[model samples]
Target: MAIEVASLPLPASADPSKFVDFGKEVKGIDPGNLTDDQFKEIQELLYKHDALLFRDCSLSPEQQYALTKRFDPASENYGHGNNKTGSTVKSILHPDLKTIPRVPQVQLIGNGTVYNHEGLATANLKHPSHTTFHKTQVSQIDEDAGITRYYRWHIDAALYDLSPPKVTTLYGIHVPHGKRQTIRYDDGTGDELEVPLGTTAFVSGKTMFDLLSPELKSLAVRTKVKYAPHPYVWMAPARAMPTGLGIESEGRELPLEELPPWEESKLKVLPVLWKNPVTGNLHFQVHPCGVMELLVEPLPQGAKREGALYPDGAHLTDIKEVRELLYKMQRPAIAPSLVYPHDWKEKDLVLFHNRGVLHSVVGAFTKEQVRAFHQCNLAASDDPTGPTADDIKKYA
Candidate 1:
């Protein structure tokens, strides 16, 4: 508790490295009126500012679960388990919680859920009576040119073997206020390039390892990338539909394939560069649709994977060309000048760093705009926090 950094409180706008605004000197901000040295100055400025917006704050889901357990480092189990996904849609109304708390760490995202009809948004929808499983109904149906893939860039499960969410608070009950949508892409020489639509976006793995090139940062700190969660993810430009971003544990609707064999043998072997123990720098977690392989762990035994983005290096036996050369070495750190898209404001209170930010879910809200959001996650150590598929045996 010695985080006395000059008695904190000086961020009414420090867009220096993008994001740090306690919303014009705090007014509507209330985590029961923060003070414990402002939750260790907001967990040491999100361990070196990856993103932290506060705007007109108006919490009280128990004060957003006691200010997210004061920047929880697993605050006596923050959450990742206890299988969530119980909100068929009563239009979630959280002014100070009249009802909505089975406590899985508060989660009730929007798009007016009811994923597939049941009646006037299922009057007072609240079906969660101590589990019984089997209620499937979170459809996407189909979309690609019109988008609705529900979006996802990912970093949450980071493959999953555990220790994924360090912090990822989000609170902004109901947003999406009209006019703004013009996304397009593919300009490699064939027209079409609009973009503008990056709502809950973020991607800055320490600037993707400071825009690598020290021989691709020594083959990304001697590679270790290997994942296994893709049973289906067709949401690309022309591939258009099939998605999977809301992997609702075991009962919230979202799993389709892959992840069974003891949770895919717990495959998550990360390390395509690492070091961010709260801003030590260097991050490039990699997630080209949940990677499948690439373990050239030889940085000095016979090194030569040609330094990322293949010519003949990042090869894990061609799983679609190592997933398009790791999404073209991670598309310039998910571009848009190192993505940080979060314009939400209805009572904003974002706080990211889920292992170095890599979010998704950007636009499309209209049914008379009612966007809702109230998530929570924490993990630094306390792995294996539920959410499985159970059909493992991956990557050979």
Candidate 2:
């Protein structure tokens, strides 16, 4: 039987035209047990759409891992590595995940304590909130009044040793429902979005690249980003901007000397844009919070240089300068009209292309409001493909 697929429901605020092929809700197939042809067709759909949702699935950690591994057969370790976050106590991610003992590659994430769950006798999960990470947060009064903020906008990657996962699978085992909260951008533009509590907000990296001005596009294709070694630990002392788009430019980042022993050789220097393997589309895929430097190549020879950002090429060492430029390029694509905040239900399985879109955990949950989810993503066997020579020449 042919798979049943339909476009996801977009908010009225979203520009429908831009999301004509962005996300899809696929029904009538059990993802954990797909035939080879079914898996192949699903793979094609996932790349073209970027995010796929399968509702009412009965998936286990073993099944989730199997489904995720099909995307990268050679990969078996978790995206952050098996139990790496638990051991990296200084990392900002330490509090958010609990590895399932039997299925170490699948993590049990979400709020409140879970007992006897998939080989875990007891798991205490904390829902990540802007209050703990953001420099400034809505007051308790405001929070009680239903105001919230985006916890962080990022791709699912360790950004240290492992290559970013190509896809991430999140299965909601227990979903908590509540009134929608208003997301205040708090970046001084007075932006706000009404989203369901704990919704996962997503924005297209393709759209992020597409929205850039010609000059920024020229810069994006020519630039590469250098991530801090042990980035999560490096940024633990830092604070985030009000928008949660990137780090606040304070001198609070941990010094390289203070971070967990890291080698210069292990530091990541990756392209600012990742090329989609199947579709050949370029996605503006930088992790703004972890970036430490920008290595910009000069405009390609014989290409248009008028109004080019770095016609002579430059290595930007100033953290503030690098962050400002990235913010200017990325923030616009996450406006209220461009974001897709999925209202999740129990048994919902969302598969998103980690390289093609940026996503965030949107709100907080009270202790009593338990949310249990099985999250799985494998560190890819290889790094994401950057633009081809033809891509550079065309964009430049």
Candidate 3:
């Protein structure tokens, strides 16, 4: 199908400078105080820029959560840590367990053990609210030792099988070396991607969610509960077998035990295009972690006995091939015209569409540097067909 493109919605002013005072130094904006015109301008900028960055505004956690409410309700039930920050706010990027001896608050968002039962793998679709939040702190890893503990480029909270978040926000608290960076491949072109400070890119979750294809829509229909087994039991290494099932009989169940390891260890990355149900615009592509490939069945034709031929009927040719394809879809080379880069400053708030853009953290900083941010999601109503006026109202 020919991909449809929506004309970029530019704000009334040709230069973005005229819309809002970029030089003003305020910790954050009170969403309730925003005028309709200002809100419209902010919305248009979010759609056009994919990501926005504010500089030097100091905001308290409570203020950050209050600001998020302007866009979406507080997701009280989603995150894993203390709820003291309020239902809407969640922490991202904290000290490592080994490095920081006694601070439980230092849990890295993507690191530590994947606690399946601790609500890490549950889908938001099952909840009556249809909205969820995830709070993660970044852990330190010695990249020189080939121990990169950070998550590879993937979407936020893929476990939520419902449509991706309508909007996502990342606020930088304490950047290391006075700098933090996030690599964003808004356009597909792998070659000329933009790398900006973490604070510079603002994205709309709605735009991100809109980029998903119908195939993904079908997958999202399957709730988190169905996929719960894999997240809970499989991601981590298995415990040793009991004594009764000793060495002699181990071979009999080798395949069964091995299946979970393969299933859990393999990485899954989704395609970049999301078909917008409301505007029919093909928002920017999203690179989510799971939902990349469902079940890869063996080919009916079987492997070729001859040279260089792939096995017939294989859902995916091989893991290497899958990685290559994901790289092609993910890099910044895909869409050069739409990508934008920004610099980070303290107390800057960004709102973005989860479906439209691909975002990543710059690998330059160490874990102890302290990059603090709060995030929230503006969820569409349960209907997968499209967003309704009611859905818009929920965020409003």
Tens-place lDDT per residue, model 3, 145-188, is 22211123334433332334545655544443433332322222
Question: Per-residue CA lDDT of candidate 2, range 272-291, in tens?
Answer: 99998888999999989999
Query: How close to the true structure is residue 143 of candidate 3, measured as C-alpha lDDT?
Result: 27
What lDDT score belongs to each candidate, Candidate 1 first? 0.48, 0.93, 0.32
Clashes of 1: 12
lDDT of 1 by residue, 1-396 (tens): 232222113222213353332112223335456788676666667767656667677676567766766665346333433332232121111211112445555556665443322112331222111011112222233222333222446665434545566677788766756544432223232222123332565666667666756665555555666665422221111121122222222222123342233356765666665555654665666655555568754444334544433324445855565665555566555544345455676887877766666776654544444455677764446432211112001100
Candidate order by decreasing lDDT: 2, 1, 3
Q: Which ten residues in a row have the lowest lDDT in candidate 3?
A: 123-132
Top model number, lDDT: 2
The TM-score-based order of candidates, best leading, equals 2, 3, 1
